[model samples]
Target: MEKQELFKIGDVAKMFHISVGSLRHYEKFGLLKPEYTDQETGYRYYSTRQFECLNTIRYLRVLDMPLDQIAEFLRNRDVKKIQEMLQQQKKRVVMKQNELQIIEKKIENRLQQLQDTLSSELDTVRIIQTGPRRITWIRNKLRPKSYLDLETSIRQLEKQQENTVVFPGKVGIGITKERLLKKQYETYDIVFLVLDQEDNYNGIVEELPNETSVAIRFCGSHADAPVYYAKLANFILAHKLTITGFSKEITMIDYGITNDITKFVTEIQIPVAAI
Candidate 1:
């Protein structure tokens, strides 16, 4: 009988660029077993015969296949099984790619919003024209007097959304036209998430058409909203503008983005038309 060449566990790990513990894990998982083990030293050794199996394991792992699935495939070892697994993994990869793209888009939008808010003239109200916006909203008399109350409302909105992705910098609280006219700034009638035109939504959606709006950006959170809302009201009154729609008060920067209170920026936009 010819002597078969064998590599020690450490040498095999180094060759494969994997940790030695990974080999032990594979053995524990019953995925792969060493070709030989010294009884006295309890050292694991692998021969060239195991190289193909290890290579297959490494390849499947790179495809993000679970160890159990890889083990099943290795045990079955058929062309049809591998083809089906590859198809299933390909679908998973495509799904992940789509999810990652959505995440990337959200990051870009958030960064752009932060830049816009930082450069904006704080506390200065202006009349600006805005295009249509789509929003998913939950109508409730939510007076977020404290941070805890605000979080509770947000969680409620999230629950209503089911699996929809809520993008930051796009959340807003609404005050009805009547409430605004009555100078009711403490109570919010609706909590809404602004959605991109391409966003997949499962809740009630409304499209707000293009209109001129009274807008102001200020350094504040929900607690500081009343002051800014009053400023918008004053601006609208001075400009002889009639409030035409619900207020869109979004906190552009908050604890979610940073903990510094001084850096907080909130914007209030209310659709208005010249009276």
Candidate 2:
């Protein structure tokens, strides 16, 4: 009788391009066992017959199948079981693709916003027509004397939201129509998260109708907002426009985004109408 050839553990691992530790792990999980173990040396060896099982293990692992599931299938595999597993994994892959698509869109929007902010002409007030915008907001007396106060207010607003995933560049502070008329620029009456058209939120959502607005982008945050508010007020007065709604003040770039104070940019948009 002819003796069959067997490869050592290291050689088998090298053939499969996997670490020897991985083969040991598969043995520990009872997923695969070596063809033979030398009693005196306790060294492992694999016969060529075991290669088919190792190849199947590698194939399923590439599909991200859990080790326990792979072991179960290997124990009792058939065409029907493989077909079912493939369908389930396909569903998981599709779901992951959808999640990636949403993430891609958010990255694209953030990139555009940063580019627009970098190119914006600071301190120049302009009257522009804006489309209707939707926001999920919380009404609070947020006169931020410090960064902590502002952070607390944002946390409170997030708590009120059903969807707690707040994205950057979507948050804004608003001054009431009366507050703007009174020149109370430092005090904000509401904090809001502007919603994309696809966003679904179960909270205090409001739609600000399409209207003309006096807008100005500046190199500052809420702390530097009072000066820009004064500028917008002057622009509105000079143009004979009346303040019609809450002022939307959004920080395009701020400490939350970057450490550099020079990169900070904030924009204030006040809805208006011709008198």
Candidate 3:
């Protein structure tokens, strides 16, 4: 019988479409090994016999199975055991696929929000009817002094609500009627996450019902919120629309959407009189 060809590390990596370091990583984790190694030079080599094992390792990795799991599967080499491992990996893959779908839907929603905000007339107030929405939120009466503190609190809220909000969650905040009336633009009392109606989540869920609202979608960072709030207040007064609820500030296009402060859209909505 003819001897099968032996491949060097670089050649094996190319054949596997993986980096050399990855092969080294696999070997370090004991998930795979070269068929032969030179004792004196310490050079590794792979042969046809190792090819099937290497391919199996690669397949398991693509399914996101941990190295330890793969190593255990390889060491056992039992049909039932390997089948059980593969079944668990299949469940993980399906979960990831479902997560990706959720993420895609979130992207679509953000894009639609951006399109709608950009198309609307800047600084113009409009009275529009909005349907009911449920939100899971964290409220802080005293706003933080620094961005770091604010971010830390936000992170804590997310951690607390990790299982409460679905993947790719949308965050928003609310300013009180007193604040808008007093021009306390930077002071936000409540921070909330917008929840889909069908989302079965646990947390402080608040239902905002349908109402005619005086809303102004403005483009800029939160620093510009005060000015837009004033604009919205003026529009409400001019149209004889009485403020009916705590002003809701929806971050239509927030820091999550873009890095440009000018592109961030803050929609100030205040439920108004039906007339």
Each prediction's TM-score versus the true structure = 0.90, 0.87, 0.77
Leading candidate by TM-score: 1
lDDT of 2 by residue, 92-198 (tens): 98998987887787788889988988999998998889888888777888776434566776776677455544666788889999999999898899888887765
lDDT of 3 by residue, 1-275 (tens): 22246788888899989999998898888877877777888778888788899988888888788999988888888989988998988898898898788767766876776677778787778888989888766767744332233464466456744454533225556787766667677788876667764455655678878988888877664556777877877887778777776777666665555677666666778778944
Ranking by lDDT: 2, 1, 3
Model 2: weakest 10-residue lDDT segment is 156-165
For candidate 3, give the lDDT. 0.73
Angstrom error of the Cα, residue 67, model 2: value is 2.8
lDDT of 1 by residue, 137-192 (tens): 88878877544566666676677455656555777888999999999999999888
Provide backbone clash counts, one per model: 0, 0, 0
Off by over 4 Å in 1: 1-4, 160-164
C-alpha-based local distance difference test score of model 1:
0.85
